[model samples]
Target: MSKAITNNQSVDLISDFKEITKMRLAVSVVFSSVAGYFLGAEVIDFVELLLLAVGGYMMVGASNAFNQVIEKDLDVLMDRTKNRPIPSGRMSVKKALFIAFTFTILGLLVLYIINPVTAMFGAISIFLYVSIYTPLKTKTPLSVFVGAFPGAIPFMLGWVAATNDFSIESGTLFMIQFFWQFPHFWALGWWLYNDYKRGGFFMLPTGKRDRGTAIQIILYTIWTIAVSLIPVFGVTGRLYLTPVSGILILILGLGMLYYAYKLYKNRDEISAKKLMFASVSYITLLQIIYVLDKYIRIWI
Candidate 1:
């Protein structure tokens, strides 16, 4: 009976840590970094790849933890976030801060071992997310725009980790991910607008389900697609995509655009949710295509 109680406590602790750190989101960030590393790599180094994934996850996890600490009160006002560890009272603010500080120091140290540039960007991402984006969320709708800077870093950070240098190829990766965030986030913003409003947060551009916001989403979708295809022009150095791969990516873009149009046409919660899923699908599948295309080209 005593052993059972101890096991239960351990499980609860793990669950609380996961909630505080946003385990799924952190893993997705790590996935983006790994995909970027693969794209820029000449020969895969398993050791370096492992370090990048570990360091990347730690940085993202630290960011999420800090964000929750900042938004603890606001989070309680929203249904979606009320159950999160800090807001739910399952985890104390002191404990969460300890995790955040530890992760930040150790994460930067690990990244610095890779290269100063990679560590520098990692620090910038943390600063932007925690210091800039977290506070700005309640103040202005432009927070998403500011947040996208750090959100887009994981992919580009991977390239820098592998190459130890930032070049046109790395910039192109950053720009593609940067544009992709608007549609991805705005769709999420649309569906979660009510919850966000409850927290006194500014999410959507207009802060309402209006034609203006939908129009902007559609426009950004087009821009994202256009940027994704830039590599096909043989202009992005080592990041060039073949025509066949370009067509596949274009198809993915059109699929995402279709959902954005659906949201624009319907302006309903359901359509907004669909757009959110579509955007996620687009980014995940696009990364797969990029990695596969590069490896296939090398083999051929």
Candidate 2:
């Protein structure tokens, strides 16, 4: 009976790890990181790509694990989060902490093996996300600014990993993702106001889905579009935007903005959810365009 109980406990541990790490979210974040790597890399190395996927996934997993550890108490307050492993009593605090540290160390080691700069940035991202942004989320809305730093790093992290150094190109990659987050997150805040409020997470600048917040979202949406088109003006180095590509990008940006404005004008839950979905579509489509544009020019 004791041996059978031990076996059952082992299976439960594995299950709890998956739940605590938010495996789905972790996988999506790593997918974005891999997509960035493909866009930035001149040569698609299978081994390097594997390393990137592993390191990126573990880094994100570590951040999320630490986040859950810190917010265990608050997680129980939110309806959407209360079923999480930590808050639901499926995972112990000590076990979660151990997993977080293990992933953090292994992720840094994997990135370092790939390239030192990659490891450095990976470490920095983990530090910022776990130490600063996660704790600040409940304290102030400025946490969004803090959170964006780590959130945007994956775009440039891939560049540095591929090139083994930072460059203006990497900065440009960072800028694109950095500007994209404000409008994306604000839309989520608009739609999930009650859910976020329950946990004391101040996700919006105004803390209310009002005209002021909506206006900021629209302004940032415009900036996201403009920055995306900068390559067309011949200012973004090897990242050229042909007239056709530029036009397409502009259309997509405007589509995103159209919904942002609609949400602002309507200030309704339905509109907010629409804008939130649009924001997800915007990022995914923009990345696809970047990759497709590169391939199209190569084949032409």
Candidate 3:
């Protein structure tokens, strides 16, 4: 009976931890970093790869936990976030802070073992996400821009982790993801505009779902596609995209643009949701194509 009670307590704790840290989002961030590592690595190192994954997860998790701690009150005002650990009373601020600090220290130490540059970027990402972006959310719509900086870091950090040097290749990766976030996040903001308003978050460029927001989304989508094709110009050093992959990327980008255009025309929730999904598909497919193209060129 006592063992059963202890097991239940353990399960509840695990659930609370996952909620506070946003495990799924953390895993996706780690995935982007790993994709960058593959692009930058001359030779794959499984041990270092494992460390990157774990450390990346922990660092992102720490940032998310801290964000929750700071936004606990605001979170309660939104349906989507109200049940999160801190806002829902599943976890206390003190406990959440402990988790955040533990993850931050451990993550940075592990990244430092990989390389100092990697650790440096990890720290910067956490600081920017928690300090600048989180607080700016309620103040101005430009918070998305600030958030994009940290949001874009994982891709470049992966490259730096593998190479221990910052180069044009890493910069290109960073720029691609950086621009990608605008359309992706704005579409999300469009769909969640009401919820965001309830939480006092000014996430959209126009502060409302209007033509201006949709037009900006389309503009950023175009920019994202253009930057994604930069490697085809053969100036990104070790990062090269074959013509076949480039065409596929263009097609994927067009797909996203089409949806963004539709959202502009309709200016409705359904259209925004479609744009959101397309944005996700575009980034995921683009990253996969990049990794696959790299290996394909190696074999050829």
TM-score for each predicted model, relative to the true structure: 0.99, 0.93, 0.98
Per-residue lDDT over 1-300 for candidate 2, one digit per residue giving the tens place of the 0 to 100 score: 999999999998887888777788677667667766776788988899889889988899899999999999999998988988899998889988998999999999999988999999999999999999998999999999899899888877877777787877778778888888999888888888998999999999988888999999999999989888887777766666678888988999999999999988899888888988887787777777877887788889
Every candidate's lDDT: 0.93, 0.86, 0.95
Clash count for candidate 2 is 0
lDDT pick, better of 1 and 3:
3
Question: lDDT, candidate 3, residue 137?
Answer: 98
At residue 261, give the lDDT of candidate 3: 97
Query: Which candidate's lDDT is highest?
Result: 3
Of the two candidates 1 and 2, the one with more favorable TM-score, higher being better, is 1
Q: Which pairs of residues collide in model 1?
A: none
Q: What lDDT is reached at residue 184 by model 3?
A: 94
Query: Which candidate order results from sorting by TM-score in descending order?
Result: 1, 3, 2
**Order by lDDT, highest first:** 3, 1, 2
How much does candidate 1 score in TM-score? 0.99
Candidate 3, residues 189-242: lDDT per residue as tens digits? Answer: 999889998999999999989999999999999999999999998999998999
lDDT of 1 at 156: 94
- Winner on TM-score between 1 and 3 is 1
